[model samples]
Target: MPMLYLNTRHTLPMIGLRVQHNTVDTPITQPRYEQETQQARAGRGFTQPKITIDSYPSRHSYGYTNNTDFARENLERGMSEVQKGTSKHTQMAWALAEDGPKAGRQVGIEFAKRDMEQRVTRQRTLVAAAIPDPVIQVDPGQTHGAPIPAKTTPIWHTEGKAQITYHRGSFETYLQQKGDIHSWTSEGKYDIYA
Candidate 1:
């Protein structure tokens, strides 16, 4: 027995290696006008709209999924206010009239209050709906842990945004006459695993 001894090592065969794929959806940044105008240039294959950053003071960032109509309406309101004016300066002038300061002051105060309210409302609307251009990428590894089970069905998920960025003026400084409106762009990132 000692003279005729044999050694053997056993190994298990590997079935298959698991693989994952990730796809990212780019954020929509261009306004509707641009989106439509690009159609002519797009021909057939070019679907994505391209926008250039204007010289106007605006923020470029990611915006969450939102109602474009709402944002557009508010934008129109803001534009209208800019065109027609908020009646703030006139109200102040009336309030400080020299001869009839007392009577004029009362009417001026009312108008001033109304103007302030309108400005605040306008600002909040813009801020609430302002969506800035944002870039989003999905990392499959981060989305799902390693060692995924073999022969599993694909999974779909949307990662909550870390931050929401939007264009337009600040809510705090709505009263200031910045006098311009910017396009709203919104974007979100999602991960699909298979």
Candidate 2:
């Protein structure tokens, strides 16, 4: 079971926008024995008859036979532009962390005393666990992408360990499977990636 093959070689030339392709292997279509519709299974299927191929791939090579709006303005002059996101230094780091209004009210009262010491250590470990029944019944259209119904809700959690999140549509499906939206790229993944 020795399988460690990498060979990861991608050193240049991928100049895309190809617009022309080919791959065919067609040759097959024959069943005109007088358009035989089972004449008693072609007279009891004679044993000297077997010709089957029926493979097709000839789409007369794609479309566009000149309805040229200057060939779509030369395919939009090598079409590309579609990148976004620009929070201007994340709104100047939250306006320089709220431009010191009394040191942002002492860092919001030390984050409300560390969120009241994590809600008094989660109400003292839920005082021996047995209060969860609050969901009496919430059929918001058969409950799906939930969490919004709330009279008062801060049930902030995470003693850690609980994953499966991946945001931003799994980062644009991993940047459309390893990005290259027809080239012209720039990264510095926002907030200047720490």
Best by TM-score: 1
Q: How does model 2 score by TM-score? A: 0.13
lDDT of each: 0.45, 0.38
Tens-digit per-residue lDDT, 1-194, candidate 1: 22422333333443443334343445644333211121123222223344544422223223322467558868998998876664655545655675345543466557667868887888443345454344434433222223423343444444455433444332221232323433332234221120
User: Any runs in candidate 1 off by more than 4 Å, and if so which?
Assistant: 1-67, 82-85, 98-194
Name the weakest run of 10 consecutive residues (lDDT summed) in model 2: 167-176
Residue 159 local lDDT, model 2: 35
lDDT of model 2 at position 66: 44
What alpha-carbon RMSD in Å does predicted model 2 have with respect to the real structure? Answer: 65.3
- In candidate 2, what are the lDDT values of residues 2-71, reduced to their tens digit? 4333222233434334233343434344333322232222222223334443222122123223455446
As a whole number from 0 to 100, the lDDT of residue 110 in candidate 2 is 62
**CA lDDT of 31 in candidate 1?**
33
The alpha-carbon RMSD values of the candidates against the true structure, listed in the order shown, are: 54.5, 65.3
